[model samples]
Target chain A: MVFENKNSHWIDPYTHKFKESFKDINLLDKKKEYWRFASPSIWYDKFTLKKFQETRSSQSIKFDVTNYNFLRFNDGILDTETLRNFINKNKNVEICSFESIFLKKDHWSSLKFCQAQLNAEKSYERPLALFNGFNAKDGVFIKFKKGVKKDLHIIYEGNNKKNCCIRNLFDFEENSEIKVYEHFYGNSKYNVVSELFVADNSKFEHYKIINQDISETVIYHFFGNCKKNSKVKTVNFSFTDTPVRNEINLYLEGTNCDATVASMGFGKKESSICDNTVFISHQEESCKSRQIIKNALKSGAKAIFQGKIFVASKAQKTDGYQMSNGLILTDDCEFLVKPELEIYADDVVCSHGSISGTLNDDHLFYLRSRGIPLKEAQKKLIQAFFSEILDEVSDDNIVYYIQNQISEILTL
Target chain B: MFEIKDLHVNISEVEKKIINGINLKINPGEVHAIMGPNGSGKSTLSYTLSGKEGYEIEKGDIELDGESILDDEPDERAAKGIFLAFQYPIEIPGVGNLSFIRTALNSQRKFNGKDELNPAEFLKILREKADYLNVDMEMLKRPLNVGFSGGEKKRNEILQMALLEPRFCILDETDSGLDVDAMKQVSKGVNSLRSEDRSFLIITHYQRLLDYIKPDFVHIMAKGKIIKTGGPELALEVEDQGYTHLLN
Candidate 1:
């Protein structure tokens, strides 16, 4: 169901642990909030406390709710009376902006329940100024299901003069898959931190296409987890996210786990940067991980890629590869890639490679000799260069779409 | 239809010249064989005629059809009906042979105010032409010259020549990499496209090709300058004496 608030649409609050099994239980008070932007492990605290109190009848620590709370409500910032009206509309459901809650009334919520819980919500305290302004009022909560897949596309556009935090709880179950193509396109701009969580044997393919059209700097934080035999692919296609940062930390807690990180970005004019920092743990044997990043910079634009891979002592027989290739279109177009691999297991196979270069003159002339004009010749060469990676795109149609984009970048 | 008068070329960035005081003329429907020893600037002359960059033309005039074509770019020269089948044809990835031919043909046609051919129509016409040359459709679809054997690349060059049908075609060591059968087949293709308004300038160090496509006139180039000009029988004499008698 589509949520059209008729006014505003922010992230909805969800309060469910995203997985069935838990290694730790939280001993915190229900009213207290953890540190701002807790690490991946602190998430266990949020999950344990909510699962303990929410299920009244079934004392079982395991529950799912997003599979049922697939209902749509108005999203976005609202005035005092408007928020009051929204809460009144969902009076029968446990509607709290700060806490992760599960309403067993919609299929969407039920889908989340199958993963681990309905929603694992994080509460954000609003500033005194946001009470009158449009900051806290615009936040929203969306709960997804276990088997069904949906696209959450957004253009984070318009003028943003204040700070606002957006939260979403996407819970999945075993033997389920979902793809979320989220785009963070802003015209005026604001900072956003979005988090996605997946359960064991469940897969989440997330694509964050960020475009920077803002006068102010924007930072986007992403936190995700992958369970045993689960697949998670995250892509960062950003055009100068003026300071876009994607922080992905995944835990392969089960044997035979697989995860991949692929990213492509372009920076133009006076230092546009993206820090793709990732930490994938090979906690079990027979896990595999691959990371690839391609960057092309122009007009003195700057880019940075910092990637980390870890093979735990017990992660024997694991396989991993990390690579980053970049092209500096102009002499001043600066690009730097830092890739690291930390292995504690002696039986693992891991490698990393990086390369940067300009266009080839001989290749250019060979095309010209065949009578292709200059621009068209570059298109062919560049297409051939990027095709190595683009051919890996799962969809043939998407390959053509990206080919056209490369053509567009060349034409400009 | 091609003439080079007082031609002087420098292959390096310095003022030192490669071709000095060269003068030659090639008429329509005539096969001009340029037999030169190694380091005689045979490749330089071909590239200069095709307007390759970094080669400084110190002095001279090159005329095609009575018009001075010295200032033209390579593609422009190509558009003006000039084709060069290189000794070592460059490989261009992602450019199919058929599309490359069609693009070259259409560019020339557009230069002369003609319409372009669509892919389907171009493919039909190309298939017919390739059949005449005994070429395959697979070669047309693959990237130009990529993964092609030496003889296959030469055949591909000839196929490109047939597709473009330029007014003045230069064969730069086209016979070097071909076997007897390939040389015969390529000669047959060229002979089929022979017309009164088109000319061939075949550069070779050996005279074996003269047996297939008999040249009407043969010019011997020594140290970048033409030292002897004769009929097809001169090729026979060069094969007999191996340029030793010509130098003497």
Candidate 2:
């Protein structure tokens, strides 16, 4: 039995595929190639299929989002009142739940297109993403109309829930531009999956802030499909004290597409583990992709980065680059990096580099010789190490928030 | 006001002695130059005075104002007004040149129990000093010496020295990578900082720089020791001939 319900809506067939795929996944497989640096047993033991009761906590939203369209989710459940208010205010954009979008019939093609993209090749092979799909409930669907420019804020706040799962789908139409800010807060074992579809000549910018409690765990998966002449940029700033994993997969399926995925993470406690796994595929000719990952680790913390760029046989003139840098502050901490470039095309430009070391002694001495104390000089260099990624962020408020978070983690 | 007595320094890793029994003294308002060939331990002496690690002082005492400062850290020594313009200025990416200098200034001020200057006040003073040294205001906005030309990097070191206004300054091979024009600009900057209460220890391999800065005393160093000490004429003699005659 592929699915328990046969007479359900279109979502049943889409989710049934994932349910079948989940049966073949073994989360406890220690010898898994992708999970070599980071053991899967840690998150596998913490996985829970039992859903938690939803709570009503509107006051938990801490960030100032008064200038943008905001959506708040408490314990994996959306606030219907806030969604309705946003839907009423924004007429050009179509925002609704997956179930409601299926009934619209006008958006059925878009849904099918996204599902086909996900089903193509090995895109949906990730076990955690499959688990999220298997247990997926109704998720929000946002479609930006042609040439629409707007900013949207999504807040995921948990009320001490033991386990929760969330899925969000974004469809960017041709010539449209949108910036989405996703903030994850509170205490919970969260498994989230976000799927994005960028049409021709469209632009999509994604910014994520993951600041969960020290006792909880977070596993996030991002899948982006970029079409002809589209541009997609995603920047993730993670300052979590517990085990957190971010897996990003982007496919350049059309010519002249450009995609950039960058992340900066901080881990300080013994239990802190931050992992970033990225795979970018250039299937079409003349496409470009960049992956930049950096992390600062202290105490007994550990961080891992596994990034790969694949250029297909037909992907001539393809440009792909990957860089992973780690700064280890203490003797006990560890940073593991694996950067790979697999190109089947002869006329492609592809490169990757990985470096992990402590703060530079010469730089420290130079600063200290100018009268800056040892501790302060260290902090300044660490801050400067992460500033390259911070300079890419445009929003002042988000930058300020991230700076404060970095300072707090450093002080700890 | 600055002195090194019976200073014996060994490379910490291999314990190979580099400075074998060196003694030097410089009173206030005097500029002293140490001219040496390659591998003569000139830079090591400067680094030792500035409290760089990896140099073991087997038998020595560095004194400032009649107080021993062998136990102080680099920053503590800086607060006591000891500065070393590195032979190769370290390149720190993502740290603005202006901000780094300002931080250094404020840190020294705070350590001396004086008030720190805000950005506006610091920028005003930095602009005035930077202009006098022929430093482009645009360069200060970039990361410190990251992609700067050799001349630009040397000039930046002088800019930092001017901003800190240290009483005891040590220039280690400051003329190694500078062109004629840049050398003059840097010499002018250093000359402007010379005052009645300040002293300098200029370490170089040539006498061309000494022609501009005009050191009061010249010492010829070879084989980890000073072989000859004389007035300014000693530098002219070394330049006219070489260190081989002095060593003989």
Candidate 3:
């Protein structure tokens, strides 16, 4: 049964659209190219659309929000007191709930942007994202004024909920800059979608850290639109024990736009699966796009990466690069990669590569001969394998936190 | 005191014997040079001593200070004061050179139940030693042996030898790819570390390296065994007469 948001007059129309789309969408079709390696039945069979009762108190969730503008959510429910405090402190930026923004006459442009994003032509490709939109009764909407700079920390804590879905929208005006850190915690299955609009000459950096229990499953969709001379960069660090699929789609709509996406994941358990699907479309001239995805899988674990760069005929002088690598620790692990480049422009430079292999024996011997034990040496090499993607992250605090999480995952 | 007693070894993968009935000994403060023609198993002996995998010991024992070390791992042997400077240093693309050396030093220290040095202390020691070997700060900051010139890699190896301060050092054709200046610098670094309690095993094909770091005993090796043992004059004999006379 689809979730019905009868209370919100503005969101009911999208919920109805979701129900209509669900009739034709088949998530478990093995014939579908995108769904071939990852069968949705693994999670779809156990997913419950009915809202879960909040079984755990908010006091159980713990976080450190020092040196960050903070927001917290528990089982898809926001902490209004923290939101109020955040709003009182930051007066220049507009932060409000989706329903309130839709009702406000002065914020009609923001509402229109949200409606257009919901009705995007490519929305049908991702059925789970539409499901999230239908069930997400209330979500945060943030808009930055021109030339503003800030760092925001958003945390989601799940307490054994059967299913939790949330949506978020970010708007960066011209010449503005912002860095967002999204963290997911606890044992609830999650369906999340975030849309970003980057205006001319703006910079937006998004970092996501997913560390959750082995029994949970997470499906995330990220969409971005970049205008002239805009920059959009995102780094994802996933250290989860269960299945996780992160889908990212970025469109370069204006000239001189730059978009970069990088992800690092480690799958340790036999049931672990980490999937990343990314598409970058260059519709304008002189744009650049880069994607780097790396994963280290242990015995019986699996990793999948399907990335593509699409350049339109008029998008001349486009430079696109993509590289995907997997380090298989044992013979039983699997790494499936399909890196594609679709170029219609004659004057474009695009390249893609995929490689999967075990650790080099000579490198291992060198370290062991130097007095580093075998296990420590292997750990160091594994850390080094992910160092390239980690180097792309700009914040030191986040890097340290991610490194700690990676170490913990490795030990497990 | 390091001793190799009638050692016999083979390449484990192909089961081809490389070291056949070799015996050698080096007391405190003695520098031994093993010179031989190609395929003489000098490198095999060095690798066998360093506990590298794939070199199976079929017979004989390798003892350090009167204790057999056949069962120890490479790292365990390293903690017992054994160091081998490779002819071709492996390139690790992401591990920093300085950090690699520091980790090695600390690993040995931990194995020996000693306290490890902090970064500041390790850096101070490394800087002092690296300067002597002509290894600059930039080379140490880069990935270990990645994109380094032959001389720079050899110098980096010597710097590690200097930092680790092993009691029994094995130079496995360390001067093969080095120029005259680099050879001199490496020789000087090795000579500086020689003392009453330390020993050296220098494996080389040319006598030019021996001219820089003089050896106390020179052994001519051929066909997986040492054919003859003499003083430094034996190296000059091989350089002038070649190994045909020694083999016959």
Candidate 4:
């Protein structure tokens, strides 16, 4: 059931109908391979559906994005007034509600694509996406015209015990480029699903930072599709003590396309679980995909990384690489890494690697011998371990922000 | 400046004594070289003195400037003006060489109640020392000793020693993996840091390094004990007659 008491104005009748109609689907089965490592049902069983009214604090938050467009989401609900202002200010960009696409016959294909993604068997394999499909109050749909270049900053903030779902769709036309910064903060259950479609010769840089309260549960799923010669880079930076599961799937459907998925996480508290799962599919010739994930777990925290690369039989000359490294900081903590490569193309160059261990004693001795304190040395090494992956992000401002956040995570 | 009396150390994993009843002392401005054969516990002595874990000190007292330092942590010992240059310098990826040295230097300064240097001030001193050692400033931008050659790593160790400026230095086979040219370069860097207020304990198996930086005293160690001690001529004696001949 969805939030029924609070004034969820954006919650349409279709969402309610979808929940009731799809009650028989067993998407959260514990036996499913996708959910095998992290059994969501354990937490799902303890949760009860209810309407939680979020109090608007007197302290308003402001982001320094004077040169960029900003969108705000309050507990899975969009601010229509601000959205209208954004659309009015930007004449070349098209931003609307998800339902608006269904009203126009000329955009029928876009709507069909959304429907197929929402109902596809593979998408349903992830229970959180299905949960979002039947509960999202409203979704934002953004499209860029040919040769359009812009920076969009999206903020998600909320609190209390509300169970909320959020959906976002981004469509980039040919030759267009966009850089997006999505920041999430709060203590609440969230089911967030985002779909990105990159057309030929288009480029997109998507940065997602998750810094939620330790008592919250977050499940985020991202699907990206790249066309001919298009490049897409998605980086996820997460530091949470609660249960946070991130699933990223990228499809290289067009020739000469390249997709890079890089993520870094730190689990810092007892029983804090952070799981990152990524799947990349190369379906065309000469397509390239790279995945690098790093995690540092301390205390009794646990971290898991599952990465899979799939090269189709016809996708010759595909270059796929995957690596996952985990730094276990304490004896009480646990880190598990699983890297898989499924290649059907004979000429493809595919490789995968996974390594997990504690800090090197010799390295530690070297640092301490030079007079660095134990704690300071550990922090430096841990930060350096993540520097390689952080360097992949081209934007210096975003990288700086991430570095500061990482420092905070360690201190906390 | 540095003294070890009746030092007895044993490995924790096994019941065998690695450092069996050794006594040594070094005054200020003196460079003492210890020549020992393989399996003579030379490394064990260095590790025990540097406060590495797992080596049980059965009976010993290590003193720096008349203060016992056997119970101090590695960082504490470093703060008290003791430095060890590892035989095999470790590679720490992702940590820039300049940053590591600055951190180490500032950490000591902080412990000694001195103000830390700003980036500009630190860089100025680093450039001076690095240039004096003929070390490329570009190499400082890379990770600490990562991808460095054998000689480069040894030079980095000396660079750190020069920056930290410890009162007492322990060199653990710093010349084992270097050619003649590289050895001379490393020795030159070490000699540049020599002063009346500093003392050094150079541990090596060969006498070649002595040609560049002459030692005031030389000792022969065998079976975890200081079997013989003499002036610089002892190093020549060992060089002319192998360790086996001297032991016999």
Best by DockQ: 4
Which pairs, if any, clash in model 2?
none
TM-score winner between candidates 1 and 2: 2
TM-score of each: 0.70, 0.94, 0.93, 0.91
DockQ for candidate 1, please give it. 0.39
DockQ, all models: 0.39, 0.80, 0.79, 0.82
Candidate 1 ranges beyond 4 A from true positions: A1-179, A184-208, A211-224, A227-236, A239-260, A274-292, A308-323, A341-351, B13-16, B94-103, B138-145, B175-189, B208-214, B232-248
For A21-104, candidate 4 gives per-residue lDDT tens digits of 457656466677667777866335335633211221122223356666888777767777768878988766888865454455
lDDT of each: 0.63, 0.83, 0.83, 0.81
Q: Compared with the true structure, what per-residue lDDT tens digits does model 4 show for residues B105-172?
A: 99999999999999999999999999999898998899999999999999999989998999999999
Instruction: Please write out the lDDT profile of model 3 over residues A114-177, one tens digit for every residue.
Output: 4434534352367777667666655678988999999999988776665777778888889999
Error of 2 at A45 (Å): 4.4
What lDDT tens digits, residue by residue, belong to model 3 across residues B26-102? 99899999999999999999999999999999999999999999999998998899999999998888787877899
lDDT of 2 by residue, A67-156 (tens): 779998877778897799899888779887644554654563454434523733373357777777767554678889989888899987
> Interface RMSD computed for candidate 2 is what?
0.6
What is the DockQ (computed on Cα atoms) for candidate 3? 0.79
TM accuracy, model 1: 0.70
Q: Which candidate wins on TM-score?
A: 2
Provide the lDDT at A15 for model 2.
Answer: 73
